[model samples]
Target chain A: MYRMASIIKTESLVKDFDGLRAVDNLNLEVEERTIFGFLGPNGAGKTTTINILCTLLRPTSGRAFINGYDCVKDAHRVRSSIGIVFQDTTLDKDLTAYENLLFHAYLYGLKREESKKRIEELLQFMDLYDRKDEPVKRFSGGMKRRLEVARGLMHYPKVLFLDEPTLGLDPQSRAGLWEHIVRLPESHNVTVFMTTHYMDEAEVCNRMAIIDHGRIIAEGTPEELKRMVGGDVVYLRAKDNKMAKEILKERIIADIEERNGEIFVHGVKGDVCIPEIIRILGEQVLSVRLQRPTLNDVFLKLTGRQIREGSPEDEFKESIRSYRRRFDRT
Target chain B: MIELKVVYVIVMRELIKFFREKSKLVSTMARPLIWLFFVGMGMSRLVPQDITGTDYMRFLFPGIIGMTILFSAIFSSISIIWDKEFGFLKEILVAPVSRFSIVLGKALSGTLLSSLQAMLIMIVSPLIGIYPEMGQIAGSVLVIIVLSFCISALGIIIASFYESLESFSMIMNFIVMPMFFLSGAMYPLKKLPLVLKYAATLNPLTYGIDGLRHILIPHGMLDFPFYLDIFVLLSTSAVFLFLSTYVFERGK
Candidate 1:
């Protein structure tokens, strides 16, 4: 028997809201000092699981532990051992950034001198030291988010949980936030547990679990999960499609299918297969292109549905519309 | 010790927010004065002096102070609903602190703010033709703190059942108006009909206002004895504090 060190562990965790199972019999183990991503679409039990682990929601059954403390029985110990950046903004917009951080420091029981020092250090690290005196209401979305990240780290917990840290940020801000998040583990010596629906964002994780319908469908490194879709996809248009299919079938031992006047060669190395297809159908080939399997393909292969169902631009616009609607209500 | 710090910081946060909203302080201070000058001056002429055993304006003084504590103390706990609406409650809930600390912090802040407002009203007691000795003023202030603590805990209990400002305000209007009218803050509790008198006796604020009258208007018409007023206020504060803390802890 072997034991792998895990900072966060859940065994057969289940949570039910009314009759609906929000988190269905789940087991998860996350190694220390690594970025662990829980990849899922909206309502896939991401936030529900995080809430349970953070001691805000009790599990319906089974158990979860953080830093060896039971989430339900030893809730205070679990809370002291973990930090969470909620999916929505939790900052007090009326308070200055420094005051907000100071408030959190006090709640976490940090001494005044130590809290002040760490507040300054974290403000600088998050690049908000210059604006620390300004009320958070005056900040842009990105600045508010960075301040929240700083506030979460004020107590120096062993694990930091970010629930969709960049859900509504612009492309530029999203990239900027990721830059800070990517360096957190190395600089702060804390394990990062984050959830995101963005497939590209999942690539940054050392290990990730693809969850859907309250169950983890796949779990591994990004590369390992993508490898589940097999080799690169080859899409080609030939002058004589039927003749090219016959010739390609006779020449190569690969699965070939024709759809909409193009032949897709599956389970073949694109670089090696592309040259051979060109030689075999020299005159019949009109255009040839190789498409590498992405996390989206892995999701599609596993669940027969697109992970993100929309382009990034479309998602951004939808988020903007919803933000505007919320703004109008307020 | 750490739990005490948690309570301190929570109170500090509310105080900082309270100071930042200068309008809130101005409005709370102004509300009691409006009732004193407008309503008190308007209604004093219609009532006979013997009914209250003093001039109507003097008789209304303690009630005005009770009104200050009632309004400010109850409204102060609305911060919980505001925190929930703004998502700040989650931050407080996720912190490694006991729910009792949070509830105590909220109740104490409300007590402090309302007591300060009531004392401000007391300082202007002369404007309403009521004069009190230093000991009477100090005793009244003690009564104000206890009453405010009780009302604030009651507010928290109501707040835990609500999640939105609209719903909270709707329910507050339903509860707060009746509480103030029935609290003997605007009338003599003894003169009410038997059923109404029983209703007033059950109100914690009635005992509080009666305590204030016992001190500030020593010769004026009084409802319960001085000891009974303090006894009721203190015991109600303890019960409310326990209930609010239990509700908060169980909410999660």
Candidate 2:
């Protein structure tokens, strides 16, 4: 048993459901007292990875450690050192805020007096002390999310995991949650491992990984990943994609993708590339429009599609539907 | 020590939720009350005296108590489905408590609430001509408590495998209705088809109703063999509870 340190570390962690690999051989090292964001499109196995790290789900193979303890071999110790807030709200709808926090504290082995103090302090920190007696069923989306965070912190866990923390919140609620999440590290020095599909959330993180198809396709600071694109981006849309590509090629302009009636061109001299691209497209009987490429472009470059593809569950449901349709026809 | 505290917290959470759902309590009690008072009374006039060997209402009272335990236990099981749907169960599963404690907490809560419902139904039994000897009420409550635990364990065990609310309700309709009927809740199994009589004997609920009847009916017209019935019911509870906790551990 190593002394408690380095909040979370995983080496070649792999998770498979039936035949489909949900998390392929993945390695991650999350430092203590840092908010590390896991960014990916939907169905990129973010939730599965989070679940494994939290000890909610065991890995299919490979090793995971939390606070210097193996997730499987020392699961209880791993669980003791981490707290998780799932993508979905999980509070008992009938319990009061105070009761929820108190229950959570007790679950972590807090004494009665310690639980009372922690609940009071957390309620105050969340600005929910005034409404502590009201059941969670009455709280708004933001308050509920905040209470979830408070509940996660009730144990003073060495590491906190938030999976898609603001997927469905209004902008105001999202912003409010961001503030709370940002303040947590400064206030508690607890390591935070959060997963989000939102780019803005990723931008706020000190470091992150872009996951897709159950693999970490890229990992770095948001700045470093964006720098992978290496220049200003120009998106050229044309009526005739083949003609556009032909024209750009003829004019000696490189780094172009022609697909689905649009041309995505990336280069250092984006402004210079635009006019040349337009003039060539005009001669080739194709209408062209140009604009800058954002992170979406970086994502498109990394993966052939947009940031992520269709969710695995969606595909599973679709196959089920098709199977039902076949049976119905018979 | 902390596992017990965690279990207590979980039980309290489940009970608090139960009390808050006013409609749940009303709907749960409504069926047993209707079956016992209105349906059972009307049917009593039809259950010719020679066949049943006791007042028809009296025979139905123990069955009503069984029904109360069944529905309340199933109602508690619905929370398992609801929590899975709403993600609350996932949260609790991920908490520091052992998976064993999670199963124990839920079963105990269901047993506690269902027994309370049984007590409430007992309060009105005398007004309906199904009065038990005061001495037997305590034994009946004890039997019902164990039965409730058994039912709750079975409910949670069923919930562990199902993924959708619609499918769960479908299973409830198919399984619970037959368990209620074939176990002699509404009618005696001795008169049913031999196949059903054999099936009824397999139903844990048959043991519960027989055991309860042993204590709750007047002058012991129902020779239920009390200790044997209680032993069977307790064994059934033990089996269901073991299966439920095993499923819970694997399911998590």
Candidate 3:
């Protein structure tokens, strides 16, 4: 139902390193001029997929095409169509921001005059014009990241691949990055493909794929995925949850779960089911609440675990997960 | 995709980076200078003129020049690991340019840097009482380029597989040290054990040192035909260049 020209398409792509498969039978399509997110925790093959599409890493089997160019056979054409910002910051710390941009422009074979004009315009757009002459080593983490993203656009690539672009940045900086990300499609005709474990960050994507253990567990627009989790969450804090849950099970035609002394009634059969729930609970119902489903709930329903706490993962990753949890709730 | 402009742009980055690290440049120049002056002068009084023709310093001068180019070529390539550690390799790898061009640019810049350092040794050779003829000076430039290209190609090949500077540096020492010593840099490839002589011949730097020796001084090793030396050096350059390019293009 989501229709736009397909900019990226992969067919049963598999990537194996040694005895392990980093990506397994991945088949995905990214529409043109939209922000597509690969939402997953660390070591879930998010970065591997991006690397294959960018032609930086070869898939063990199957094929990936970017803008109609095969990643293996037509790698050169695929490369020309896309730009990338690595998960780690890659700016030359010794070089000034302007010099870094100039060097990138040269590597991309941009004409001198055109690069100069574009460099000025890009620096202004990134709000880095004032610090263009200063060495990047002196820049803040957010500033360095912003500069790296700006450099990725030097060649005017049709598709931009960002691998955990805002990883390790503070919440404000991450939010600020989204602002630039949001402006990209408005200012330039380019599609954005990105990876993030943060649900809040994935909120920016027009469509997203939830990946786990080297496989795509679910794929759809954010709204569509959330819809899969059921429309509304009906929460009721009862004086006696055990008794209230049992009564709701028989009298209320809705799926119910209890957490922290509150009962959540999911997939309510109808709006009429809410009044029936309260009336059946009677004096045992202390309080009740209703809310829409979120992306995290969609991930939970598909993967059988939270995005951040699935298994042994990077500890710093856990920090970002907690940050997103608290920040998004606010 | 292997555009000359792309190669030039990469070479400039190498030059800019090399110039900024004044301490490294000093040490790079100093390491071989110590061997040329202290070791050459020390050996001059010990070895008779027949063993090394005129002065031992002159015989050792060409060898040191070979050493300079070889080490400069290999060490300059260690920066590739540095680039990887700093995460710049991802940017270079993901660029629209071909990996062959990227490797070409890396090797080209290493060649340029190593050749320039070899020139510094060339200039300093005269100050150490081994004056090169005008013809030898002109011809040595070609030798430096060839030797640099060959050895730099070797470094790139090693660098393509390793991501850490420490591991690559250790491996470089293990490989390059033997290649330097066994190439007749500190000794002659004359009548000796049959095995040692064959090993020296097999070493690529032997031809490079032998070529510089024939040009810089009259006491040149004519063990092989002059064309053989040129052919071997050119072939080594070609093989290593092709190999390095292939490895780099296939790399993840």
Q: Choose the strongest candidate by TM-score.
A: 1
Question: How do the residues B139-193 of candidate 3 rate in per-residue lDDT, one tens digit apiece?
Answer: 8889888888888888888887776667865775788888888887877778547
Model 1: colliding residue pairs? none
The fraction of reference interface contacts (C-alpha pairs within 8 A across chains A and B) present in each candidate is: 0.79, 0.73, 0.63
Off by over 4 Å in 1: A1-4, A234-265, A269-290, A310-330
TM-scores of chain A across the candidates, in order, are 0.81, 0.77, 0.80
Between prediction 1 and prediction 3, the one with superior TM-score is 1
The predicted structure with the larger lDDT, 1 or 2, is 1
Model 2, clash count? 0
Error of 3 at B123 (Å): 2.2
Candidate 1, residue B218: the lDDT equals 85
| Overall local distance difference test of candidate 2 | 0.79
Between candidates 2 and 3, name the one with more favorable TM-score. Answer: 3
True-structure RMSD, every candidate: 5.0, 7.6, 6.4
CAPRI-style class, candidate 3: acceptable
Task: Write the residue-wise lDDT of candidate 2 on A53-91 in tens digits.
Answer: 777667889998888998888888878888888777888
Q: lDDT of model 2 at residue A303?
A: 81
Error of 3 at A237 (Å): 10
Clashes of 1: 0
